[model samples]
Target: MSIEVANDANAYLGMKTLDTPNSNNYVEYDGNGHLTIDVGEHDDFDGPDTQPGEGVNSDSFTWFDGMFQLCNQGKAEANISYELPDPPAERDIPGNWTAPGDGYDEQVVGFYYISEGGDDPGEEGDRIFVPEGDSVPLPVGECREMGVRTVTKGVDATTDAPLIDGDVVVTADSPAAGAPNGTDPS
Candidate 1:
């Protein structure tokens, strides 16, 4: 699961893993879209080519949507990536996304972006805005349906539980309370 946190001015992205050193791992952010992680030397290993004089560098690179690009030896093949979607990505309405239903059954939802002028909502776009004491409709389309569900905070209901704010939400579309009412786009 992915978790997003606000630290001073940065947005720290944390993840859960049973393989890594810590059951949970986190990347430090600096707001300018930079994330830094310090895994011990034991965590990194050389694959094939290595020179006597050249020393391996320990560094972390940040990519779009919080993807961390790690490079060992100054080569493309030496690079590896770990991607974690930013808490919110600007998804066009009527697009496809994963939703969770009761018993944790995953469902696909087609959402229509609703705005003041029916235009594209800017960056961090047209997502289900869950406001306190308010009901929000699910984005419905040929891909999914419409429903009223409370957005999960820092919880990936499809994967992991809550840890922090800005986590991917889990939306259920079954016969339960927030099940989406589907519609045709044609």
Candidate 2:
């Protein structure tokens, strides 16, 4: 995420031009008319501020069914399918001695999918699991969100491992099922 794209990135953090090999974590996009939404990542690490697991973060209780949705992250309702990985959320650590974040997923990660309960619309309140191969259209300015099951160390983490990665494609709209002459009616 670039400082320009970060949801509340420090606006006054002046820099002497981020150029060349000195710039860390930089990517360039060609912008060929894609539904690429800048992840508004409105959340930040509340260190040790962890939410209790839904009883599936342990071997003694290894069952969980949850719902997730796609947020607008744009100015209009859009239908797009994208396979993205867990956000790279890095946190502060004490001292130079360190540990890597891997193999500890069950304790620190959450998995999300279109569970069979998706047919029930939602598991809790407005949190609906994504429909199979589909999305629940988001209103403009919605914050995109997702979850993935992983194991981890309690409270804190250092590095982030890749979860899911793929391309994003926006399909065209189709005519209403009973449209006459295959033409959509406003």
- Among all candidates shown, the one with the greatest TM-score: 2
Query: Which numbered prediction scores highest in lDDT against the true structure?
Result: 2
- Clashing residue pairs in candidate 1 (N, C-alpha, C atoms within 3 angstroms): 93-113, 94-111, 100-171, 100-172, 101-172, 110-144, 111-139
lDDT of 2 by residue, 1-186 (tens): 443442211111111112222111121123432222221121332224674222223222121232123344433444433333333345221122112343332323222434334343555334333322454443344433333333323324223422213343323233332366433456
Q: After best superposition, candidate 2 residue 82: deviation in angstroms?
A: 1.9
TM-score of each: 0.16, 0.27
Give the poorly placed runs of model 2, Cα more than 4 Å off.
1-73, 84-120, 123-127, 150-186
lDDT of 1 by residue, 88-116 (tens): 33321112222322332222211122233
TM-score of 2: 0.27
Q: What are the RMSD figures for all models against the true structure?
A: 20.8, 14.5
Off by over 4 Å in 1: 1-129, 132-134, 142-168, 174-186
lDDT of each: 0.25, 0.31
User: Backbone collision count in every prediction?
Assistant: 7, 15
In candidate 1 the C-alpha lDDT for residue 6 amounts to: 42
